[model samples]
Target: MEISQRHEGARGTISPSGSLVAHSSNSKLRPATLLSHSSIRTAAKEVSTLKWSSDSANIAIVSNKLVEVQAVEGHAHPTRIENGSGSLGRFVGADFVGRHHLLTSWEFGRAKIWDLSTGKGTDLGDLKTTCDEPAWQQRPESTGDIRTVALLTRLAAEDTLTMHFPELSTSMQPLKLPTVDAKSMSWSPDGRWLAVLDTATASPSVYFYTPDAHQYRSYPSAANLEGDGCLGVKAINWSADSRVVALSRYDGTVVLLNTITFTPLAVIKHTTTVEQSNLPPHQQTPIWREAVSASNERSYALASQPVSPPLSRTKPTIEPVELGVAEASFSSNGSYLATRDERMLSTVWIWNVATLAAHAVVMQHSNVRKAQWHPTRASLVILDCGEGIAYLYDVATSSAPLAVNAPLPGSPTLSWVHTAAESKLAILAAARSSFWILYPEGAESVSDDARAGVEVGGELFEEGASEDSLLDILSGRKPALPYEIEESYTKMVELEMGEADEGADVAFDDTFREKKKADTDAVDPLDDSQIF
Candidate 1:
């Protein structure tokens, strides 16, 4: 199947296989057109993973059988790489080492490095790692240098974490961890800390360490003391600033940690009290009311509702009830966080970072397959719900989200592509037969009216802005201008209708003299004319 894009008057139409038509407009924040590269094709039946290069100029799509690298620009044909002899494992994950080379890991702990220019693969031998996947360092931008890669190898008695520096052709000595079975490991965006989650102990624990493998702290997961089985951790994600990390547990709880202090900031539990209670009084039955009352102890209910019993009175009675596996992610600017629970797969909870409270909640009709914030846009979020249409949520704008229709078959996955020209969203179909690229026509700037409360003393104060502003300003680095500061100073002043009188003039003269003396003492240097 092939996808085609055509323009008709002010609207653009996308026709795939001559059966589906998606219309787009330029005046609103909608996808304008679709672009599909014809030269790239997958040999396997489905795509297991899709990853963009560090430079964002190419995308690597790995299938269960093979790997294909396609250039984002031009009409260049895709380069295909296959596994070497005696390696009988399927590809699990892949990462770009630099701009020119690719690292692909497979089952049974086998890996290889492929040269894109020559399409040749070099075996790295068996890694014998406890986890099938390797954790690669994430870079904000392409740095034209080899990135540091890490692998967790399991020994006979203990587990070891090793760092590999491809540029220097050297590997760090294996750092033995306290746990015997390490499930997975990840590195922070700033590359200052490493996190390892192990499940071998009686209760799962997450360990934090420095770059050199010095263990500083460890936090154990809260036990299901109410007799519910422990589900353990499902995933780990780091914030853009590297100051906070989110751990998504299988028991429908999300734990936020402060990397600097190594302490738990908050624990979010998934509950249906708020959602079910919002319905009309007729819909709330006796059974629903009982459930709501039982959930009052653990749910993060809205603040406007009547406060529940204090923690001191309800601490021992509360139980970490099992809902389902949960997923959480932070926005680009770290101002908002989004989460979804498997039990309520159609609902998404958005939390404000400054207040650590719920900002907005969204509910969809189908199961939400993926929800991600735009790479550059702070307020805009893209979501796919196993349907033909994609939803855009602008939390700062309207109460309801906007939709864009692209009728692709099977479940769809979404990823944002950051190119030099513009930012595009990639929608990969489940069949692996075709994929569509969407160009957002226009994006509305978040209004300053919503942030009027935080605008103080001609400077906008935000949760994550203060830490970097002083350092950047002192080092002569220019900071991006805020939307609130774009208005002119003259427009902010108000004038009274009546004219001034002699009495007002006399008061102004005295006030002006007092201000002048204060300014001189504050700005002028110490001199002989000044009194001690």
Candidate 2:
């Protein structure tokens, strides 16, 4: 079935040799649709990414050499990006910032925005090549894609840049806070607030921006968030309902804030040990220091004084959320949050959005590929837990989740498509030569058996001495993870890897000797004219 208006009619694939071929299928067992490369263009250029216009009338195939936007109807010549431009660099990705503007990221780490209406492109002006915040201005009513652009340049005490449309009009305004070298700043998804994080100071320096009120509030000023999140905020997520925001920190602490009141709703501290390094426990400093010291621009007397131990190092404990390779996804209903982390064990934590409490912890063996809630079923969640295994975690009932193992397990790549109409959720997992979708219900898998088995939050991988619950046992002895305790050091590890080739070890001592002898006998005509 056609997924949407833009993806209607047929499904397509781009070959490694850079060819787009269409395939048609009404169901999983249907025959494929095919087209010849000779009918299209048969050149062998590597395609880095492909993007569709919001309207789905055009598809852009991006590569190091060019960006070609092809019409869906396969009519006329594709709009080639390099047709007239001479300074275009090798691009690895493309962002359709607006319908009329295309932002291309270069291999050199720079970016340029091109205006489709005028055929003119403007370099984002030598901004940090790594800044990921080049975004189009967002307004619910503004849909035609002629939106303005906000370009973040140097994070070290920088200005907020706005480049107007058509004329490419420009404006610059310094950040409302005195965060010298902002380090990183992000606008909430709804574009209602901007959160600026500064790592320049010895402690965490965070600020929030409210555009309508033209107000900037520091972390300490926000009630309840005072003295919170010491290891620094790593990422920020805005709930779709636009009521609350979640700030996750390096220490695995999560703080929630209310938009309307600018107040902290909850502070979810991890089951981690707080170890003080440089200063003794008595000389500690609150992570959320006020306008004190050189942390924030507003001058305070503490900057010149010695460390005064913080009033308290205590935190309120909740269920321990593991630290992973940094991944979290909010449910479509905005009522749940799923998080995966890397630790001695791998787990998926689903939390109730309103209470910020763990509703379930899905323990498994494989790294979680993805966890997304069903579009229509608030209690249903689909999980892609590597090795062709899928699970339907129904929180509505406290039973082991339904399990379905597919035939494909060799794939190392998988991603979720948007939740579709009715109750369907599409999965686009990479197979051998191409990628395909698994059924919304996930691989003809029936619900797991009701009999008791080794289970972790209702997930069963295996049970044996090799799989002892060491961390679970250690956590159980602590009563609660957030109790105040003196800082202590645990462990440190340094890893080094050397690059070696299998064929590099072939005997070359005799070859090197012969080459040296040949060089000694060779004449140097250029040496005679040297130093002129």
Q: Report clashes for each candidate as comma-separated counts.
A: 0, 9
For model 2, how does the per-residue alpha-carbon lDDT over 1-532 read when each residue is reduced to its tens digit?
Answer: 2111122222344222121232222211111111111123411145555666555444566666666554444332344464222233466667665466677665544556666544456655444454344333332224344454444455444534333343344434533345444456666656667666655231435677654324467664634443543446566666666677776666556777787765678876533232345666455422211231354222212112232222111354586754422556566667877664434123556678876676665555445567766655677777675666556777656565655444564642444444434544544545534445555453322244412211111111121101112222234532222333321111110111112233354333232334446554552211111000
Per-residue error (Å), model 2, residue 462: 53
Backbone clashes in candidate 1 total 0
Give the lowest summed-lDDT range of ten residues in model 2.
488-497
TM-score of candidate 2 relative to the true fold: 0.59
Could you give candidate 1's per-residue lDDT for residues 1-532 as a string of tens digits? Answer: 2233322211122222211212212211111223311222333235566666655466666666656565544444345554433234677878887777787777776666665654444545455555623644432332464456666666676777776655554567887888646677778877778888876333446788777778877766343322245656667888888888888887778878888876778888766556435656554211101012353221122233321211112234465543455568889878888898866676777877767666676666556778888766787787776665667778776345666666555554555543222433433332233345444553322355432312111222231122122223334453434322322211221122123442364333232334557556543221111000
| Candidate 1 wrong stretches, greater than 4 Å | 1-52, 57-84, 87-92, 114-125, 128-146, 200-204, 221-231, 275-323, 406-411, 414-431, 438-532
Alpha carbon lDDT of each predicted model: 0.54, 0.47
